[model samples]
Target: MEILLNLKNRICSLGIPLHAAFEDIGTDKTVELWSEIFLNCGQIMKEQRLDAGSAWKKVISENRGLLPLEQADWDSINDFGELLGKSDRLNQESVLDMARESIALLEKKAEEAMKTKGKLYRNLGALCGAAVVIVLI
Candidate 1:
């Protein structure tokens, strides 16, 4: 469960840089930036070790610039990753458009997750954790 959450965060985290690179670095330059981003992602996974989620949050916070990633923006990121893996269109506009859509979707999701009703889910997590400990004992 935590792995999924962290992966969601990482995927959203990746879109932040990719979106910025598309806008700031321009289409012609993003290939290099994409490679660099992948490298940074691998390093994030490696360096975080046992505390990956928090460490990744910090790493992303430090590098995410002004683009705030919310809880709602997280769900579609795994789907986006799947599409990216199968996609063969490496052209500038194609990749840029995909990145743009991902950014928008993720941002929207984050906003939704912060809404009033979503607070209930926090207790559910605690319940699940307590169940696990009970099972262990």
Candidate 2:
């Protein structure tokens, strides 16, 4: 999300090209897999002169399983890819912002679910241990 936001700011404010922005962001070490994906997409965009949408879709499809993104997150990314290079810069920035918001919402929901389910599972484990102890006694 931060990466996408940064890309949006660079593209919108700095007027850097999409591929150039990706290549620059790809240098980050903490996100090696995403960095590789960004590099591949950047190369495709530069070498093949493909649109941002096409390059992004190609790279994402090839590396879908390795992305560590949920289906909703992938859907947001796909929507962003579909919008990229197909519209004006303002529109692209708006699309990125929307994707960021949607992904944030999904993240919040997932965290809440984890908290609830984690507590339930912990309680169940404790109950099962108590049952086993009672049986032994």
- Candidate 1 lDDT trough over 10 residues, lowest sum: 19-28
Query: Ten-residue segment with the worst summed lDDT in candidate 2?
Result: 78-87
Which ranges of candidate 1 are over 4 A from the true structure? 1-37, 41-90, 118-137
lDDT of 1 by residue, 27-93 (tens): 2333553334334544544454423334334444455443344444433332333333223324423
Clashing residue pairs, backbone N/CA/C < 3 A, model 1: 70-110, 71-110, 72-109, 72-110, 73-106, 73-109, 73-110
lDDT of 2 by residue, 14-117 (tens): 88888898888887756788889888888899999998888988999899998667787787676556666567788878887887897789789889988999
For all candidates in order, the CA lDDT equals 0.43, 0.83
Q: What are the C-alpha RMSDs, in order, of all predicted structures?
A: 14.6, 2.1
Best by TM-score: 2
Hey, what RMSD does candidate 2 come out at? Answer: 2.1
Candidate 2 local Cα displacement, residue 39, angstroms? 1.8
